[model samples]
Each structure stands twice: as structure tokens, then as C-alpha cells.
Target chain A: MPSIRLVDVTKRFGDITALDRVNLEIEDGEYVCVLGPTGSGKTTLLRLIAGVIKPTEGEIYIDGEPASRIPPQERNAAYLPQQYALFPHMRVIDNVAFGPMAKGLSREEAYEISKRMLEMTRLAWRMNSYPHELSGGMQQRLALARALASGAELLLLDEPLGALDARLRVELRYRLRELVKDEGLTAIHVTHDQEEAMAISDRIVVLRDGRIQQEGRPIEVYREPNSIFVANFVGGANFLEGFVHRRLNGSSIIQLRGGLRVRVLDTRFNLGERVVVAIREEATGIVPSSLKSKGGRGNLLPGRVRDISFLGSVVVYEVELVNGEVLNSKVPIQMDHGRFRVGDEVLLSLNPEHLRVYPYPPIGLYRELEAV
Target chain B: MPSVRLVNVTKRYGEITAVEGINLEVEDGEYLCIIGPSGCGKTTLIKCISGIIEPTEGEIYIDGELMNGVPIQERGVGYVFQEIALFPHMDVYDNVSYGPRVKGWDASRMRRLVDEMLNMMALRDRMHDYPMELSGGARQKAAVARALSSGSLLLLLDEPLGALDVKVRIALRRELRRMVKELGLTAIHVTHDQEEAMAISDRIAVMRAGRIVEVGTPQDLYLNPRRLFTANFVGEANFMVGEVAGSSGGEVEVRVNGEPIYSVRSSLLSSGDVLDGGRVVAAIRPEFVVMEGTDGMNSGFGGLTDGCGASWGGRVRSEAFLGSMVRYEVEADNGVLVAVKLPSLSVGSGFRVGSRVTLTFPPRHVLLYPYPPEGLERAISIE
Candidate 1:
């Protein structure tokens, strides 16, 4: 078991800063995923932790010991890149045994260790097969087996599932996480996919432009993002600007720019203070319009379904409010076919608690995607 | 107004059959998407309809007129290619008006037509921009504008939004569907992505191995797919091998590994009509399976005979929180079944990876099918 720490680590390449003063601490057996868009320095962070590259500034600590002086080999960490880099000339078993044999183990001893690792990764049958003979997912499994053959406590993977298809990726991610936990190993994975990171990580570190945007548990980060970029990146949500209009009991009632008032959890803003609301598309549901408006009791806005789309598991509807602002709602696919159509009147209902009110962002919502 | 019809269309390359006997109808003002896995003959079928490759057999009709011995130009159909094959040398305005100009239209008529098409596509401001000067999305918009500006009643689109990113593709698909309806054009789109086909089209025709396996509205195909392939293709589903033990009291009970599993009686039996001792396969979508926590779990059962629908002593295998939804795998009886739930719909904290739970779903959520002639999994396995 080993804990890892990085204190204000910075890396630079001439005029460009690769990573800007990052601080991270991983517990002994935690699975942490560093997630971000491409060019967000995810690989750079992993490389620095693996001791392949030295940080321009700050300290690297491993298990309470400063690792600035230790060589890459003695760090006892294994790194797997996007592509599985197995020995082309050797069989899968030989590749997995290579790490153990390099550490002065006899041929028989190395093979014995390789057998156990292969079985753990569900690659026992493929041990005698060459890397080229295995499917994409099988080759990835072989890579994992090789990484763990060294008996390393910390495993670092950089987009290990990037090359697989959508369905295969989903299945392999769970197996990978399960294997890592079953072996009681600490894993830090890096990927650009939001779903992959959320599905497997105990904690997520979201990065943007050489800086850490947010860090927390996957559900926490997804449900309550601290920044506009984090919210938009993790899940697509519609942003609405409004101002606090009233306060009663423990809630604050806000008036949207479209002249509709909504009640939300109390915030620090004073009366008439401008704020922004973030609503997940799935959090809203639809009811037919011409129904009585349930104002003051809860949140309900009258709108007309402008468009309808079937997205497999979910049915999406683009509805235009009476004030002419369009909002998207996603509901589960109906068994009896579509329950609504284009040009139908509907009332959008969402609990006030599901409506997130935050201080108006400096970059604003429209410019967030462009900034990425 | 044009209605496209394909009667027993089949195309062969030398000795290999690229498309086999696909019979389809695209009603006037309809949007139909042909979807399947890669190498499923989707492109080959589209090519036959586009007249790029004439069918080896069968007749093609457009607006009730036979199109035999006719070229693409005479068929009066517009093709919006996925590769955005715009002329790099010409500006958007010139490119869009090229069709009418080549067809021998006057300058004033061409200008009026191109102007209206550009305005509807929101490419008027970028009309003077060249293909290289525009972004990928902009270039795609220009190509669509050019295709529609030709005044063709029928449009054949080959994955028009396939080349873009996911978010951009979704936004553009909405706009593209709206425009197609607003301009009143009949569209037949080809795509390999099931979600894209579901989102944009009025009906979907699923293909496999040069064969059109199924065709229906998105709702009909997804909720009530008759074939095993269509059940797995349209959405996420769980397949279990079982035997039809009996039916009674508005409920059909099947035996999975010698344990009775109850599904609602409203089923179209595909495997066999005999209610007793008939081998069968049951398909259930993950979203419909309901997982109740261990405490007071049995108190919910109000109307059931012989305790058939209730499955107890199930343990959670794994859990994944996928943004909009959470998926859970549970081990019950002899197999691992999945259930998908929305956080809002669940009560309190949901089941963890190792918690005990009960699994049940009404019969309407399940679809039973007879094993195909090839094998039980042949239709489900894309590989």
C-alpha cells in the first residue's frame, strides 16, 4: 500500500507551460481518474508522477518520502499508455513475465508469477497467444497483466480504453476497476471521456488548460459542479439568468429573464441580485399545456413542444416557453410509443431543489464552450 | 410531391451480393433512416437508390413513375454526401446556385432560389466564403443548402451529421430535421449510429448482412421489436433463455433455469404457440426492471398468483453512475441481470454494489421471442 502526493508541481517547455503548479494527494488504495478535454495536460501529470519527467518547480512525495532524488525504476509504479506496448516478438506469457525476470527472478519463478497475473486479468487462455492474435480488448487485458506483474502497488494508466468501441469500452471499464480492487492496488487513470471517468473513479480530478478545475467524488462533481466549465464538460445543461425577487421561510424566489418566477434553496445573494440557474435536461418532465399553472407551490412553466427526438433510451423534446425561450427535456422512452409531438402544448415541471442557482459566471454560459 | 419506392431491390458485385431484395417505401414528405452495424450493406443499398449503382434486379419508382434506364439527373433527387464534396474553388453562393445554373435556369430565378435556401440554412452571411474558409459545420451547412437549392423533391443523405462531434451533431440534427420538414422535402438517410437514426427520422429500417431485418417507427421498433436483432439493436436489452411453463390470470410465466419467472400475458410469442414445454427466449430492457431494497420488499406485492413475478435474494454486482442515469448489475438465480434507474425516481439512497434487493417488472416491459433458425445468439451478436 502506498500513498502519493504532489506539492505545487509545475512543468514548462520554453514559452509554453505544460502543467501549472498542480497539487494532488491520493490515498493508499483509492482509484482516482484525472479527466479533462484534450490538451488539458492529463498525460503530462501522469508522466510526472511516473518519474519519467522532472517537475520544473515543487516537490514530489511518495509514501511520506520526497521522491525528487529517487530514480524512475525504484518508484515501484507501472505506467500503461493509450496503446498496449507489449513485446512484439514474444508470446503474451513471456511479455507478462518480462518484468519479474528483469528483477533477478529465475525463469520458472517468473512464469509462475505471470500465470497468477494472467488468471487475474482473465487472459489465462491467451497466455500462449501472440499480442497480434488477440482482439483489441484482449490486448488491453494483456497490457494490464504485464503492468501488474511487477507487483507494483500503484498503477498509472493513460487512456487505456481509448481505442475500443463504445459498448466494449463500457464493459471493459467495469472489469478493469474490479480487477484493480480485487488485487488491492492503487490506480490512477487518465481519460478524456466523462462517462468513463465517472463510472470507475472513487475521486475525479477535472483539469483545464494546465490547471485543476475541480476535484471530488464522481457523484459529487456531477451533481454539484463548482465552475461553469466543469458543469458543461461533465454534462450538457441549459443555463438561465435570473435575479432573486423574494425570500420566505428557507427558500429564495427568483424571477427569470423570461418573467417566470422560481423558488430555490436560499443563497447569499440579496434582493434583486442577479444569478444563473443550471438545470439538467433529464431533471425536467413534460405535462400538457392548458393545465392549471401550479405557481407559488412549485416550479411549472407553460411551453409548446417545438420538436421531438428519440435518442434510444431517452426521448428528448425541445419546448419553447410562452416567453419564447427554448428548453430541452429528456424523458425515458415510452413503451406505448411517443406521448407528445411537435406543436403540442406542454407544461415543464421540475422540482425547485433540482434547479441550481449560482452567482453569475464571469465568462458567462454562451462563451464557455468556445473557451474549451 | 414525390414518394420513393423500392421493389425487391438487389445489387451484386460480380458474385457477391451487396444488397439483397430490400423492399421499402418512403411516403411523400417522410423522413426514413436506414441503420445497421458496419458492413451491413447500408451504403450499398443507398447507392442503388441513388442510381450510382443500378440494382441487378427489381424496379425503382419515384412519384409513381418508373425510373428504369434513367440516370441520377433524371430521377429528380438531391444527394447530400457525407464528405461535403464542395468545390474548393467556388464560394458558397456560386456553389449553391451551380445546380440551377447547370440546369439552364435564368440568373434571376437562380438568385432567388439560392437566396431562399441560404437564408433557411442560416448560411446567408457566409455566402461569399469558400469551402476552406468555413469550419466543418459551416461547410456542411453549405453543402446541404446547395443540395436543397437544386429544387429536388427527394433527398438522399448519407450520414450528413456523421462527420461532426457528438454535441454538434445533436444540435445540427435538430436543425436539419426542422429544415427538411419546413422545406417539405422527402428524405431517406443512411447511418450506422442507432441513436442518430432514432433522433431524426420518422421511421427506421434496420439492415443486417444485406437484408432489411425490420422497419417501424422509433417507438414501435424500440418498445415492441418483433425480431431478436431489432430488440438488441434499437436499445439496451437483457436476454435470458427460458421455457414457457404456462399462462393464467393475465400473466405468462416462463421458467429460467428451472425457476419460475413471470412476465405479463400481453406477449407476441415468437418461439412457439404451445404454452407448455416450449423453449423460448425472453428480452427485457434494463430501464424497466424495478429493484426494491431488502427492507419491506415483499410488502409491495399486491396482485400476483403463485409468487411467480417475485425474485428475491438478489445481490448487487456493480453500479455505475452515468450522468443522466445509473446502471446496476444484479446477480439473481443463475445469471446476472441489469437494471437502470434515474436518481430522481428512486427513494432515498439507491442500492450499493453489495446490497440485497428484489427484482421485478410487469409483463408489458418484457418481449419474448422464439430462437431463430441459425442460433439463439446469431441475431444478437454483431461480430
Candidate 2:
């Protein structure tokens, strides 16, 4: 178990800055996920911590030692890249055992350790099979088992489950987190998938333009993101431009473009201040406009259903508000039918507590939400 | 637009039969998706439809016209492959207009079509960019737009969005479907992503072991799959081995690990009558499994909570928060591992690891089937 600390780390490639003065600390046995869009410096941060690449400025400390000068092979770290290379000629058991045997353990001791790692990854049944005989999912697990059996306190995983099938990817994420927690190992995972990060990581660090935008627990970052980019990237949200109109007992009323008003559970903004209200797609509820009486207590806005997409578990309805703004509402598929058709007028309900208000950025809303 | 019909189509590569006896029909302007795991012949089936490879046996008809020896260009079919294949020397505009140009279309009409296609794919800003200058997702989107602008009445795509990011893939898949529907083109899409298939396709064909196992609407395949393989493939479902104890009034009592579990008989979507004392398997989707904390106000019997409910004690083994849903794995008292998915709104007040809970499987939600002859594990295996 080792803790990692980065002090003002910066990495530059000629005119391009890959990482810029990032400071972070990871406690022992903690699993931290670095999440970002493409070209957001996620991979660069992982490489710097893995000792594969040195930072251009500042220092990196692993287990309370200066690790910038250390080479990758001597860092007591196992780096599993996106494309894992397994020994084709060796069996699954031998592939995992090779790591321990190279550490000068006896053959029996190495095999014992390898067996336990395989069991944890659900690969023990295929221990006698060659790498070529296993599926893509099995090969990934084998690579992880090999890394774990290497006795490295720190594991750097770069999109370990990128190549898996959709269903297998979901199943493996659970197993991966369980193995890391059970072994009490420190892990830093880098991926462009927001859902994967939210599902497995104890803490998520959102990166953008070679810098850290926000860092917190998965739920905190998802529920209350500090910036518009973090909120949109982690989980897609419906954005509405509004201004603080009035304050009501720790809550604030926001006025929209068409003079429509909505209530939010926030009072940090002053009256008449411009702000944007963000609501999660799933948090928004929808009902037919004819049933206006059923809209009990909440902010109900009249809209027409423009489109509906059934995503198996949930249905996403795109409703065009009377002001011509489109809001998406995700509803679970509970019954067989009775879903709103495309032309039906509907009422969108936004609970005050679910709406998060943020001050308008210097740049426009679209520019601030851009992933690039 | 033309309808496509494949009658007893089979493709063989010496000793290996890639696809066998695949009979499928695509109605005019219908959007059908063929989905399966790798090596399940989904790709091979799409290739056969695209006329890239001649089937070893059977007949293919486009608009009731025989197409046994017709060339791909004469078929009037647009093909988009999983792999990137764009003209290297041409820019995005030229590549999208290639098909219309070859057909001797006028400049103004061709330009209008190309512009519309580019705008729909969000590649208008990159119209002058070459394939090498675009990102992976953008290149794939361009490839799709090129195929759509070709004026082909039939479209056959093999995992067109497989290489895109998750967010991009979701957005592009919806756009792709909308364009196909608006243009009134009959399409057959092949992919391994079940969610993508469910989201866009008018009908889904579940392929397995070089054969079309079942074909139905997305809702039918997901809720009332005729085969156990489809239930395991389309979504997450928990299966328990049991023996049928008795049946009455559409409800069957199954003995799972010596505990009585009630399930719906008609939910099996089968014809045969279930015999008592016969081995059976109970399947339930995670969303249908109701889990309640034991410390809550109401307490019921450990065995049966009501007339149609079967309750059991369990301990939460693990929990995964998946944005909209919270999935929990529980170890039941009968030694069966059950998965339950609840809306994430209840996450804060939900059961945690090692919390004792009551898992209730409503009879209406439980599906019953005769234990697969090949065993439950083999029956549910995708490979």
C-alpha cells in the first residue's frame, strides 16, 4: 500500500502543454479515476505518475519519495496499457506466475499467489488455457491478474476495459473494483467514459485542457458540479439560461427568456444576476399537458414532445418548451404502453431541489460547455 | 425503396460455416438490426446482404428480383462497414458526393445533397478536411453520411458507430436512425451493442451460433424473449435453478434451493405444458427484483409476503451506482446470487453492504422455463 502525491506537476511537448501544474494526493489503498474527453491530458497524468514520462516542471512523490527521477521498471508500479500484451505461448497460470517468479519467489510460492489472483478475477477456471484460446474479456482479466500478482503497490490502468463487449464491460467493472478494494491496492484509472468512472471510482478527478477542473466523490461531482463543463461531462444535464429574479427563504426564483420563472434550492446569487440552471435528464419528469391538474407541487413548464428515443431501460423524450428551448426528460420503461407520442403537448416538472444554479461564465454558455 | 428477402441463406468457408440457414425479410422502409456476440455470424450475415460475399446456398431477392449474380454496384445498396474506408485523396465534400457524381447528376443537385448530408452529420465545418485530418469519430460519421447521400434505397451497416466515444455513439446512432426513417430507406444494421440495437431498430434479430435465433420488436425481445439466450443477451437478468413444485391459475411454484419461489407460467412464452416435479429455471430482470431494507417499518413472513409475492432474506454483497440506476448484488439465504436495480433517487437511503434486506420477486415479473437441456450455463453462454 503506497500513497501518491504530485506537487505542481507540468508536462510540455514543444508548444503543446499536456499537463499544467496539477497538484493531487492519493491516500493509501484509494482508487482514483482520472476522467476527461479526448486530448484532455488524462493519459499524460497517468504516464507521469507511472514514471513512464517525467514532468517538465515540479515533482512527483510515491510513498513519500521523489519519483520523477526513477525509471518505470524501478518504480514498484505495474502499468497496464489499453492494449495488454499477453504471452501467447504461455498458459494463463504461467502468465500470472511469471510476475511473481521474476521477483525471486519459489515456483510453488509464485503459483500459489497466481492462483489466488486468478480466483479473484474469475479466471481460475481457465488457468490451463493459452492466451489465444480465451475471449477478449478473459485476456483483460488475465492481464489484471498478472499485474496484481506482481506485488506492485500502485497499479496504473489506462482504459483496461476499452475493447470489451458492452455487456462484458459492465460486468467486468464491478469485478475490477471489487478486486482492487479486496487487495487494498492503490489504483489510478484513466478513461474517457464518464459512466465507467462514476461506477467504479471512489473519487473522480475531472480534467480539461491539461488542468483539473474539479475533484470530489462520484456522487458529489455528479450532483453538484462546480463548473458547467464538469456537470455536462460527468452526466448530461439540461441547461436553461435564466437570471435571479427573487429570493424566497434560502431559495431563489429564476426568470427565463420568455418571462417564465422557476424555483431552485439555491440563494447564493443576488437579485437580477444572470445564471444558468442545470437539471439532470433523469431528474426531470414529464406528463401530458392535458393532465395539468396532476402537476401537484413543482415548477411545471408547458412543452410539446418533439421526439422520443427508447434506450431499452429508459426512454428519452425531447420536449420543446413554449419558448422553443428543448429539454430532455428520461423516464424508466415501467409499463408496456401509454407513452407520450411525438405531437402530444406535455408538462415538464423540475423539482426545486434537483435544479442546480451556477453563475454565468465570462465566456458564452456553449463555449463553457464545450469538451474541446 | 425496395424490400429485401433472404431465403435459407448459408455461407461456408471450407470446414467453417459462418452463417447457416438465415431467413430474414426486411419490409420497405423498415429498420432492422441484427445483434449478437462475436463469432455469432452477424457480420457474415451483413456481408451476405451487401453482396460482398456470395452465399454458398439459398436465394436473395431485392424487390422480388433475383440477385444471385448481380454486382454490388447494380444492387443500389449503400454499405457502411465497421472499418474506416474513405477516399484518401478526396476531401469530405468530394467523398460524400462521389456516388451522385458517378451517376452523372447535375452539380447543383449534387451539391445540395452533399451539403445536407454534411450538415446532418455535423461535418459541415470539416467539409474541406481530408480523412487524415479528422478525428476517428468524425471520420466514421463522414463515412455514414457518404453512404446515406449515395441515393441507395437499401442500407446495410456493420457496426458503423463501434469506434466512437460513448456519448458520440449515442448521439450519432439516433441521428442515423432519424435520417434513415426520413429518407424511407430499408436498412439492416449489425452490431454487438444491444442497447444501440434496442434504441434505434424497428425490429431486432438475435443471432447465435451461425443462426437467427429469434426476431421480434425490441420490447418483445427484452420483456418476453422466446429463448433463454435472448433474455441473457438483451439485458441483465438473474436466473435461478429450480424444480416445478405445482401450478394453478397462471402461477407456478418453483423450489429453488429448497425454497418455494412463485413465477408466472405464461411469461415463458412457450407452448408446452409444464409438468410438476420437473426441473425448471426462474428468470427475472434486475429492474423487476424489488429489494427493501429489513429495518423498514413493515415486516412480512420470510417465505411469502402475499399471494403473488415470494420474499427471501438476503445480504447486500455489492452496489454500483450507474447514474440513473443503482444496481445491487445480494446473496440470498438460499445461496443464489440475485441482482436488483433500483432508481438512483433512493441511493442515499438505500441498503449498504452487509445490510440485511428482503428481496421480493413478484409472480408477474418472474418468468419460468423448462431447465435447458444443455444446462443453464451453456444455454446462456453467448459464445
Candidate 3:
């Protein structure tokens, strides 16, 4: 039996619908990351699974049995908020032991479990320190240790490292993932950070406006995003608005605005259907101006460089087409930095295989276009 | 003329020394960024330079004149704080015009200056909107315009985009750099984001513990970091402990554990300088390490065999997909884990965990640093 399961769950807050008929299954010892933007129902989904907030109309099952009657404390799950929320008056060791002690464990047992957890989190040296004396990262680790010491089968973390500095965040992400995997615990983490979700989760469920946008492995979601929003939000994408003109063998020719034609690998749409072709900036490359006259086969556009940004590891160039559409191209920073500048005309070639196409909903049609 | 200069500047608050004995020079129209972690004194340094706070010791000069005696208004410097302090009661036009008005400029001149500043900041369309009505990014741009309306030669920005979202931060960073460059304004921007500082600044000054640790162009800093802190802070690095085994011909072999690895030529250390077979830490960048099959036929560096040039064998322990690249954590024969970043396209399929792989780092990419700085472990522990 799976550790936790939610079937046809829908949550509504008055006139505002937060989650709409969402179904999810988390297996035993699986580390699942619930990823989405702010106010996108990620927290709500976690809350529902944790039994903190009852679903509006659905059944939540644990070990193949309905758990609707179970309260949060008896649900056998741990939920860690964005803030560590440790007791300000308690010392680090006491805070971690609180959960185990509340579960009726003896003082000796609770102390042993808390000490082991704290040691694993690298906070054993600071166990006697109060919450106020601990650093942000240390406090987060203490909260994690407390959650683990609670002896829950499932752990739910809401933006666990959101309050940490970049360096500390990076370090804690690896440590957190290691702890979860080593302890063989099922975890459902909620975060808006795409990189953090991708780095740590076995599978990611990207939520948007109370609905699941896409759920898959990090590579699957990144390489083949299901929608425009997924492509743009997962990393970053340069979107080109176009209509499908023809479907060739395994490839489709897209006719963009301003009479530009692009060959894309996606053939899910019929001819004459408007679609948006999205490509990651790193997938595009720049060629010399002289190469424009060579009559490239497909996926090549003539553009003038609008701006160039040197970002140590990579260089992002903004190129403006004759029709005024802007496209971004990223190259390795080791390449000649001065090779391209603002106002320089260049040819940009996009790999057809890397292009993702989604149906371009008409403007003023619905809010769905921007929701992805 | 030099745009700004600070000589042995120091600042203190009670027992805390925010900035200590800092010296820096910014050229005319140059964009310099001060980057560090929080409490690293980046903001204090910027404040001292912008005349927001007087340095406890040392002098600040702008265009070859002492700026200590001159008030902030007469220092000919523009300052933009992290928070957008626009006058909420006034319209955009009036707020932008306030700087010129306070400097005793006539109404006609102030109007012309405000109009030009608004147009330059791309706020001409919303000149009548109140401060609360503008977007976060737009408000920051307007604040910048207000600073520039008085024709200040130097601009100081303290965590200007610290509160914006990721997308807006990226867009505004490019726009901010362009606006500063287009107007030929010298800028000193303080930020905690290393990438942002690298993306916008012509030069960067990395600070740590109230001192400037390193100063160089972004490329220079990334390619050749002089200090251990700079190497780890600027980007990802794999530090491996090795020893100088021997030198054959022009190549130097550094034996790590039982496996021998070759390093690039270094004139800083001689045969006598290194204790025979003494250990050192080799810092290698993940980008430089190529998978065995990915490089194909060219397995050895510069056509040298016997692992003399640049090669190391490791077993892949874990791998993570980072959108553009796949980062692999490999446990080398030396038992040290090294991370190697390969372009996603280069590896047809991602490397599976526990796959034995041989990695190669080009000679130019490997940096050699002593195993732990002299007397630093004690100092770090004391804090």
C-alpha cells in the first residue's frame, strides 16, 4: 500500500477555489516535491495531505484506508513550515525532543532519538543553544531533525530552505535530500524554487492555480514541458508565436508572425492551428552575419543583437528580429566575449528537436494562456 | 579623471568593525560591483563612498578632490538605496523633479531635467502616476531616474533589486546596466548575488569580514581566483588533496591518494619549494572535466599517455539534471568525490549511478592551492 493517497480532492475558500479535484499518490519512501508559484495551491495540497485542513470533497487514504476522521496530530505525518517555528524558549535539543516526548516516549528514549537526529543534522554541537542563537540554516536543520524525531511515516516540508542564503541553501538541499533518503522516509516537499525541486525530488508535481500543470522526473519536465508555462517557469524559455503550416515526416513547419518559418519537432497539432514554439536560451546558437546569406535550411532567423549580458558562466544575448520580436540566446562564457555587441546583426539557429510547441490560445479567450 | 577613490577607509559601530582599511579606485564611467555575503560590509563600504556615512579613518575623494568636508548634496554623487524612497504624496514627475529642485534649480530647468530623466528611464508614459501605482521594478527605475536628474557623475546602488522577483530582477539588471552605460555614468553597485554582480559590472570587488578579498574582472575572477574563499564563493569547485610525485619532461605529476594526476605548469613553486611528495589541494572546475566517451578518440591531453597530462578515473556515485547540464558526483580512485558538469546534449543518455567513468580536465582549467592556508584553521575556529 502507498504511504499516502489523495483522490479527487477539491478545496474551496469561499468564492475562491484553491484546489480543484486533485489526485495524487505518494509511495513508501518516495521523496516527492510539490512545486508551484506563490498562491498556486502547493501549500494547500501539503496541508490536505497532512490532515491539517480537510479536503472540501474527496477521500484521503493512508495504507489503503480512508483517513478522513483522523486529526493532524493523529495522522502520523509531519509538516514543517517555511519558518522552522521551533519553540523560542526551548533549547535546540529540547525542541527536537518535544515531538517524541509528546508521543509518550520516556525521557531517556526521547533524548536518545533527539540526540541521534541532531547529530545526523550536524547540530549536535549546538544542542544546548537556544533557537535565537542558531543561524537560519541551523534552525532549519533543527526543525528537520524535530520532524524526523516525530517518528512519522511521511514528512511534508513547505519551502524548507526559503529563508537561507544562497550558499547555505545549496548546502542544506543536499543534506536534506540525503537525510530523507537515508532514513527511508516518504516526503512531500513544497517549494517555489525550480532548482531546489529538481535537485532533490524523485518526482515533481508542478501545480498552478490549484491544478497540476505537469508531474514527472526533473529531466522529463525540463526537456519536454507539457505547456508554455511549464517551459517558461521550469527554467526560462524564449517563446515565438506561430501557426502550424505543414506537417512533414516527423517534423512540422511553423509559420511565425512576420513571415518567419520555423521547423519544430512537435507534431501534436493539426495544420492551420496557432501554436507557441518555445526554446530554451541555451539551445540556440549565434552565427556570424556572413552566415545569413548562406540560405540555412530551417530554424534559422536573421536578427540584430539588441543587448548582451555577460553572466560569468554564460553570456545571454538579446536579438531583435526585423519584425521587432526579441529572442534570447545563451552561449558558454568562454567563447569570445566581444564577438557580439548591441546593434550587431547575426543569425540565430535553433535546434528543431529542442523546440516545444503548445496551442497558442487566442488573446481575451481565457486566463489559461498565462496560467501554464 | 578617476570617477571615485577610497583610501584606507574604515567604519565601526561600537565593537563591530563593519569596514576596515579598504582601498579602491573606480575609473570614469566604469561600472564596479561590490559583492559579498550579508554582514560582509558591502553596504557599509558603499555608504562610506556615497557620503551617507563618514569613514572613521581614511579619506574619500571624487575626481581628485577631498569629499569629506563637502556635504552629500555637493559631492556630485547619485545614491539609490535598496528601498524605493519615492515621495508617496507626489506624482512621478514631481518626485523625479525633487532632486533638481532641492539643488536650487529653476522650475523650467527642473521640468526639462525631469522630463529627460523620465524618458531615459522609460517612464515617460507613466509620469503622472503616484508612487504606489507603479510596479516594483518601475518604482526602482524611477528612483534611479530621480538620482540621475541632477547630473551626478557617480552613482551608488545598495542592493537596489534585493526585493524583486527572479524574472524581474534579471530583466531590470540588464536594463539598469544599459541605462548606466548609455549615460556614461560611473556606478558602484552592492549586491550579495555573485551572478548579478558578474552580469552587470565591468569589474568586481569581492569582500569578506570587513576586507576586500579580491578585485578583478568577472572573467579574471572566475578563471583565476587568488584566494580559497573567492574560489568557493564565486562558483562551484572540486577540491582534491594531492601530492607532487615527480616531474617528467615538461609535465608535473601530482599523486592523489594512490592515483597519479597531472597538473599544469606553475612557476610559483619550484622543486625545492615542495617537500618531496607533499600534499596539496587541486581545485578543478566541473565544466572542464569531460566524460571519457564524450571527448572520444582524444582521450589524453596534448597526446600524452600514462595519465601524465590530464586524466582521472572515477566511479559515478550520483547525478542530477540541472536543466542545461547534468552534474555528476564521481568518487575517484583517491576516494575524494568530484563533481563534473557535462552538457546534456554531449551525453546521449545520463550516466547511471555506479557507472565507472574516466574524467579528463584540461591542464589550463586545474588550479593548485596549498592544503589549507597557513594558520587559518585556528583563526576560523576562534570565530
TM-score of only chain B in every candidate structure: 0.92, 0.95, 0.89
TM-score of every candidate:
0.84, 0.94, 0.89
Ranking by lDDT: 2, 1, 3
lDDT of 3 by residue, B1-383 (tens): 34888999999998999999999999998999998766789999998887788989999989988888677877888889889889999989888988778779988888887887888788998899999998787898888898888678689999898766666677788888988888889999998778888889999998988999899998878878876667777777776677887765655567777776666634435455355576666676776665564325222222322343466677887777777767778887768788877656556464777877777766556676666655323212211
Off by over 4 Å in 2: A69-71, A105-138, A247-249, A293-297, A335-337, B266-273, B297-308
True contacts kept of 1: 0.48
Question: What's the residue-level lDDT of B289 in candidate 3?
Answer: 66
Who wins the DockQ comparison?
2
What CAPRI class is candidate 3?
acceptable
Q: What is the TM-score of chain A in candidate 2?
A: 0.90
Q: What value does the lDDT take at residue B7 in candidate 1?
A: 96
Q: Tell me the tens digit of each residue's lDDT in model 1 across B1-383.
A: 99989999988889989789989999999999998766678888887778888899999889999886789888888898889989999999999999999999999999999999898888898999999998778888888888898889888999898676556667778778888899899999998667888889999999988999999999888888878888877777888777788888756777887766677633567435536877777778777666677875431222332344546457888887778777788888556565545443343345678888877755666677775668776668553
Candidate 1 local lDDT, residue A136: 71
> In terms of lDDT, which candidate is strongest?
2
Better of 1 and 3 by lDDT: 1
lDDT, candidate 1, A1-372, per-residue tens: 779999999999888898999999999989999998778899999999899889999888999888887788888899887765789889999999999999989999999989987876667877899999876767887897899887788999998777543444665687778878888889999987887899898899999999999999888888888876787788777667788999777889888876887788867678988887778888876876655554547688888998888777788889988878788898865321467888998888868777887787678756665444
Q: Which 10-residue span in candidate 2 chain B carries the lowest summed lDDT?
A: B297-306
